[model samples]
Target: MFFNTFSWKEFLLRKIISLLTVLLLVVGCENNKKSLEPITPEDFLIIAHRGASAYAPEHTIPAYEIAQQADADYIEIDLQMTKDGVLVAMHDEKVDRTTDGVGFVIEYSLEELKQLNAGRWYNSANPGLANKEFEDLKVPTLQEIFSHFGNDVNYYIEMKSPKIYKKMEEKLVSLLIQYNLIRANGELPKVIVESFNEDSLTRLHQLEPKLPLIQLFYFKEEATLSVQHYNRLSNFASGIGVNISSVDNDFIQEVQLNGFQVYLYSINNEIEMKKALNLQANGAFTNNPDMGISVRTEFEK
Candidate 1:
């Protein structure tokens, strides 16, 4: 009786419209997934900034082990070079802040840098969380990190002050090759190379097109990226990493619309973590992996 009430042409048109609606929803869902690929390629990523730097001195083996123990998705490392041309994991150009040394990281030989007590500063800085066992940890070279963690862990490495380190890109690529972390066959590594300098990222991208390179931006105030900026970064960067102060949901949505993932920097607490999730960011760099994990769990629920 319902069929008899409608013309055959009208029924055919209705079916076609329904089919188009289904098609649009599928397309919309696929686009949503594309925006999320950088975060574990499907799941959200928790990058342990400086190996859970909140609990231990950053860039030390103990810090890295703590991050791994918490099952972090990636460990974020800021790399600086030594005078002897060794690549070491360190966040600052000057060693004064985190170590018992007073000079630029590049001025010291690996042996010289190693002599500095890398973990002592944390005890004095955070007396409540101080540990006597952190007395004399050595700075870890890139090779040492590779040897320690192997392929079981993913690394989010930044070439800190890359221009200051001659052939830093080449040396980094060489080590990755030596460790079989990258291949000439276009197989990608779990590693993601990021930098604040566009030129540094460009050089690294040229070195390995298969590698995912991220361009980082800093802002003292609210952050925003122009359409032109997004266009330019898309030329080389797989995505962009911005300070939490610099981003909002609109920025995240717009960047994703331009076909790039957006990762926020330095989320250290549940409030900040929730802000990141609320903004629909792909992921964030966090100093407390366990807390990040818990916040993500609760937020999803």
Candidate 2:
């Protein structure tokens, strides 16, 4: 009886050792898997909507540079075409709102647009809320912006009304390649191509399979997409960029549960910004990168 009892004790000890070995292997694998997750809150991406428009004139070189200075993770650019078929960075379909020019942006050649003062109109008395520092800014081109900023900063380029310009995607992608911004050693300037039109985004995805695309929406209520549309987008888009008003805890949770990253846009107020952070949004697009970063820092504390 004593001999049999001793053998059973030895067998139990060996089984425990084997179980521990398996546990160690699983723990190691889990640690590596967590590391491989593509996105994280620690990234805390800050996209400067329209190149820090709150502080500078929107979509101008100066405004983009200001975004960089303000430590924005990405400078959002709006793509439009000139009469000469050149791709330029300006937000409006018409230049009347942001530029001294009175007609459509497409009506003027690149040369004519260059000669116009794109900045003076937004001076302290009007659009800029009377900030004189915004004066004399010029609209930037895709080429010029790439040359100045290089691949050091992230770019969130919006295909603003691409139907008007059939070659908008081709032009932007060609420029990206010319600058060697398409693929780099590590985290090559996270270029996020966003569009309201799913068809435009689908075309871009076909062109560049690896580049991340975001579905942008400006709905007044919850996301209007049916379950079928949402499923399709989930397969195609890396994430969704929603207007701040459209995002809430329930909606954020629903998307998160579906394994989609949610990014809220143009959040300027500290209160709303804090609410977004609480929702654990992947990122926020803001016109004031300085204020955005400041609020993010506070929230972290």
Candidate 3:
């Protein structure tokens, strides 16, 4: 019969093409890694806050790729676990703001969450930057991000509502190991973990001390910090990630003096970017990485 006549030539060609495609994707992400080196304290890095978020929907692949294209040092991901225990990229505790869905993000299973339109809200919010392409963006998982970017790109993952999401630390560590981002002795980890909860960061530190931790802070009174406070946090975290407005020259000086790197968050304008660089901050998380890079390059001159 005609069906019994097998084509070894076609089969071999299909396998070769598949193999080439996978290899190319890896190479492409590698080439996109402008700052392949793990960020050291001395390095002044511009982390893409939710991946050039001002241009594309936050926490989506298009935003991440655009940030990489802008040559940012890192892509920051805020994780929220689904009902089925899959970790996905999300910022707010509720999906109402980011997606065409209502209710807490944790209540939805991965499949249920995938059904929501994660990017349409961005178009309505920012019509000037709207694109039909972004309207269909899906919420990505930690495994997916790791698979897409590989080890070449840096990952700055922020754990949200750590107390509510029990076993998050364990799951994250397992995933990091699974992705081969975990480094051996004397090798810097490809991933850095950040959170506002000291206990969560401490737990993560215990799970993997090699992975650098960043302690985040929010202040209603003021952004002032005492040496005693710094000493307390220094035990588990290598650096601090704070609101840009919460930090001033004095705050930056204090942090640097105490041997901690300062990273200002959500910096979206030239003034803020210039302020961070001029203040000698170790890093700045900006929603516009291209502008951040451009401002830094001009400032260095």
Per lDDT, the best of the predicted structures is: 1
lDDT tens readout by residue for model 3, 1-301: 5544457667888879855644554344334322112335445788999888999999999889998899888899999999889899999989998899999988999999999998999999999999999979899998999889886677889999988886999999999999878663233346778999999988998888777788898876558765456656666777788887766675676565555678887788999888888878888999999999899889877
Question: Relative to the unseen true structure, what is the C-alpha lDDT of residue 34 in candidate 1, on a scale of 0 to 100?
Answer: 24
The local distance difference test score of each candidate is 0.82, 0.76, 0.81
lDDT value, residue 20 of candidate 3: 64
Each prediction's RMSD to truth? 8.8, 11.6, 22.1
Please identify which of the two predictions, 1 or 2, would achieve the higher lDDT against the true structure. Answer: 1
Provide the lDDT at 29 for model 1. Answer: 40
Candidate 1 local lDDT, 1-301, one digit each (tens): 6777678779899879855644554345444332221323554678999998999999998898899999888898889999989999999999999899999998999989989999888999999999988997889999999999988778889999987899999999999888877632223347888899999988887887767788999988877665456546756777889999877775677667666778898899889999998998878899999899888888888
Residue 50 Cα positional deviation in candidate 2, in Å, after optimal superposition:
0.9
* Top-TM-score candidate index: 1
Candidate 2 deviant stretches above 4 angstroms: 1-41, 126-134, 184-189
In model 2, residue pairs whose N, Cα or C atoms come closer than 3 Å (at least 3 residues apart or on different chains), thus clashing, are 124-130, 124-131
TM-score of 1: 0.84
Q: Taking the tens digit of each residue's C-alpha lDDT, what string does model 2 give over 1-301?
A: 9999999999999879855644554344333331111333355678899998886778887788889999898899998999888889988888888887788888889988987777777674355365655566677788988989886688888988888887788888888778776653254335778888788887877777666777888878865444454556654676788987876675665565555578898788888778888888888999888988999898888
